[model samples]
Target chain A: MSVENSDLLKTPLYSLHESLGGKMVPFAGYLMPVQYPLGVMGEHNHTREKAGLFDVSHMGQVVISGENADQWLETLVPGNIIDLKQNRIRYTMFTDDNGGILDDLMITRRENDIFMVVNAGCKAEDIAHMRATMPDHLELTELNDRALVALQGPLAAEVLARFTSGADEMDFMSYGEVEICGAKCFISRCGYTGEDGHEISILAANAEEVCNALLGEPEVEAIGLGARDSLRLEAGLCLYGHDITTKTSPIEGALQWSIGKRRREQGGFPGADKILGQLASGDIARKRVGILPAGRAPAREGTEILDAGDNVIGVITSGGFGPTFGAPIAMGYVDLKYSAAETPIFLQVRKKKLEAKVANMPFVAQNYYRKPK
Target chain B: MTTYYSEDHEWINVESGVGTVGITDYAQNALGDIVFVEVPEVGDELAKGDEVAVVESVKAASEIYSPVTGEITAVNEDLEDNASLVNSSAGGDGWFFKISISDDSELEGLMDADGYKTFTAGLE
Candidate 1:
């Protein structure tokens, strides 16, 4: 989708967002709400304490149905898609021939088909790539008529359960098709935020009605892309374009966990040699590390990182003031020697060298709902 | 005391030889939540239109330019702990710094209250 033109596309909830006083900005060919009148900080805090609803209609949803769907998908990604149980979701990514990331995505296995959700900005290219690579028998169908919404935070399950049966009972990374307000919807027990929440896939025509009903809940507020960025950053989640790119490999991006052990041994996926080599020897030159600036100033993206001797060692990829931490939090790539947590580092912010350290990530603890042992 | 505004949405109130400077209420509202305010040093000398301070919001960082050739006399230290002052009281207690005007004639280039109101309205 070419976005060079002055005009921007709007989602089904565009007018509703405007009426709610959302600050709309151009994002990935769509005019998305960056924040509401409550502001980014308030919206972020509200999502952490209560529930925040987000319109994710721009995200590309596709269904892959065939006898060899799982086997076909494993050829492109390192994740163990073949073993993904029914209704279970696995976070994974597509890769180029050189072990570089194409785009990160979520793959959910269903009873008869596999549901895939890719980033909105990469949807066009992703569809083209799949069409070119997949076998003729596998059908890749884009669910363009559907709109996606996410209800996230600690109170998300409680609010979602009011509309759908058996929603609160689903464990983390689970999905199912159910009825919501008389509309047949696909609801998943997962979200971008580190909280227990649901991502509901509904028809575009019924999106506004369902969104309004969800917002009518006493504990829910409309969150925008602004809070979504901060919330994910605090949870130590990677943003595709910012943290991982075509030049960075998965091992170097601190996403080694996503590569299944079976795939690592089989060596059939794209760029498996280079990826598995890095995992075995641990010889990568640089690794992604979380950095916390000591003072109040936030060292944003592209800020040069320095070692103890003030020599430049790396650069910040994603950095911002974490509202929940009440201090500036950042993440960047550093020399593998200095990637260890608590390693003292400095950031060159303008003329000043700000004191910082390589800190452990998930600056906030993950609160996913897992079944107790 | 006479108040003036710059095209960049900065406001200055001149009293005697001292000029108190802060961003306009419109700027604060547009910036959303203010996370950090980099105040100019008290002894630093600045030229008119020079970038002296910085205001960082949750989404971006913006520079504040000096409205007149001046020497920074004082900065609102309260912002060190409470940067949201720019959001709550932009024109009053949220003042960024006080400067001792080096060239009083430089103030002539700024817009008055009525002119600033019209300028901001044109922007919308």
Candidate 2:
């Protein structure tokens, strides 16, 4: 379906994307590129072997500062914030009073302030949640003028090192402020694609320049949201609205690893009573599982999953062809008994019941760079 | 043999009361890198505009409709192992099925080569 261009918002790199042959589509209230001329398959493969740049300027970037910023922030999120050393990033979710996920985000702690990267669709609510909850002395500032772009893949470090100092030396989930193409940029050694990469946040005016410089590199190609979604799917990462929502707590999403021990025990964050209780009992009703279709038909989202006896047990949340795996893969929530790897499940796709099995995720291996302990 | 095109981007090349069906290049281009295709079973009856087959690309799934009323005579087995054939040769080796034409008059409703070209041009 075509939308009138005038009704949608455009990023600062809209002109550059158009010049590069990007197929623009509506995503999260913005006209974003879904794929370039290289197409989704080529872009997914290139990002694994080389580097692909993506315009993620639609995500909301915010900074929370003032006295006890870390302590104050801890009250709203499940991940331990006070203990996170400067320049380290932690994946956390803001939960409601009932332990339901409000939104999932990445919080990067600086020397005195904390920077957050939130999902584009949930940003407005996330920002409002912080503004409404944080202590009176704290300051919540939205960096609306910044454009976020991700340089992802095995060759990402090699491509980024040329433009920014100390990029090659950064560890996974580490953050730093550096200059890229003469623009002051916030660089994070992190990405949604399972490959080793960096996310660069730049000023609106300098987004085109930085992106142009990266695309000039022989190893770097412009990747659109199509590859981004498939890459992250194969990487076993959850998309906020699809895989997790306010109705889904972290434990049910198999994201319990993101919640730290201190928070799990102390119970100060929102919905801590329920989240901590779930942690203690380990009785989650349904859990997310990786699924592989036995046949060639792709079992996409909203397809009902049935058990051995043809009784409906779950539904697919994210489903599609895993371009890298060369097979169709999906993630969905299933009853506790059917969530185990290798458990047989049937996907009711259209009129036929296609055979599928629960399997281990990260259909592609993760390649994040970490410091050897 | 006369080839007719449907608005859904399916082309049926009819010969000797049998029609070979496949998606057009424009359909494949819009779909992008087909990875899976579900072809109708041989001997199944189809009506004009019925959803006869499915072509799944890396990006999304598209339905290939029956351009004319007919009975499925044979299906393409190559698509089971190499769905990319739909992307490489959408109109030739990538054909989805063969149908025994039940109504020659139904073919009159489809567009010829020149007409199909004009029809697609107006979309852009």
Candidate 3:
């Protein structure tokens, strides 16, 4: 599956990553930085303790507007787009008619439009899906002139405050329009690294300047996709192709919480039948659960899960060494009966059945900023 | 003792008939952080190119191949407790295992220090 270099796309910050000694690799049809000189372990640790900067420019940024935009969005997704308060973000997935997830994404209801950040690999298909099903009144526009970046960790807010106004005041999932280096930017108090952080979307032309300013901060270090992946895994977040796929349902993926109560009952979204059916019956055959391998061996994805009796129960979807937890952690689908915390299980790695246990997620505790009511 | 390198980025330092084996600095840097290592049992006989150990980083795993046909003499117990030793001292204390070389002629096929340096240069 090696893609030709000429065929691969480059993000606006591609050269910057190279200049910083980033290891470039092909990802989702784009040449991306997999890691930097700091290495995955160093970068992952830096992001948890201090602020780490990331280039998420490859993700799809889109805006949907026109008459009944919010309601129309609900028809496609399970999230309650109509009731979403302005400047608030919601995590949701695009599901197929069979209740399988097409892609997971973030949606923010803006003053006059709904802004979305879809997975890079799924963005084109998602847009085509919407365009095919959308009514004439709704207008969907994919933003090609912008770049997205994430500043994550305990010190993120402090670093972001110096460049953007009022960012320190925003709560988790709050969105605001701010200026950085005189570039109009959309800043959101959210991220995937299980840390209190913010993701800023700015013009592609100003990306380098804004990034240089943020990286200039003493607390911020340049992070690559390597750390981004491990951080998200430790945070118990899903990676699109690895953790959740078109064959997995939102319920089985442990993302039922992403659906809103109104959407759950009103049931206008795709996969409503099977999704609501599983919700009502609570008889899902399999559920995504966290697995803690008993030893040092990391049970990678596709490692089969076995019960105490040696019965093949399920398979691992995402597995890696969690730098913060200092152990091998994984998330996988298992028979609902074996999804309980502390349930003894085995992982088939290299023909050996390694002992493991079903554990709760977020191996590293999340630190999202929340305001007191 | 003399050190020899393999195209697989592993180094085997031979002292008499026994050899101490570990990955090179380039392999460690390419592999990122070393989190876990699976070493072969002492008494196992392996052929040249046979997998001797499995080194795992946070992201993925790589297999360390035997440079020459040999019988495993001893394993690196330090790696079981502190795999990061592979990253900290890949050439010294971080050695993976010791193998009693069965065929001295196989050593001629492996790369010497200077040749290995040139081979690694071409990779970049």
Each predicted model: what fraction of the native A–B Cα contacts (within 8 Å) does it retain? 0.42, 0.77, 0.87
Best by DockQ: 3
lDDT string for model 3 (A1-373, tens) is 6678899999999889989999999888888998999999999999999999999999999999897888888878898888889999999988899998899989999999999999999999999988988889889999999999999999999899988756877989989998999999999999999999899999999999999999999999999998998999999999998789988888889898988788888898889999999988988999999999999999999999998888999999989899999999999999999999999999998857899999999898998887778
- Off-target runs (Cα >4 Å) in candidate 2 are none
Better of 2 and 3 by DockQ: 3
Which run of 10 residues does model 3 chain B get worst, by summed lDDT?
Answer: B58-67
> How accurately is candidate 3 docked according to DockQ?
0.90
- How does each model score on lDDT? 0.92, 0.92, 0.92
TM-score comparison, 1 vs 2, better candidate: 2
Checking candidate 1 for backbone clashes, the offending pairs are: none
What TM-score do all the candidates reach, one by one?
A: 0.97, 0.98, 0.98
- Evaluate chain B of model 1: give its TM-score: 0.98
Candidate 3 pairs with clashing backbones: none
lDDT of 1: 0.92
lDDT of 2 by residue, B1-124 (tens): 9999999999999999999999999989989989999999998998999999988888788888899888999999999999999899988999999999998999998999999999999998
Find the 10 residues in a row with the least total lDDT in model 1 chain B. Answer: B52-61
TM-score of 2: 0.98
Off by over 4 Å in 3: none
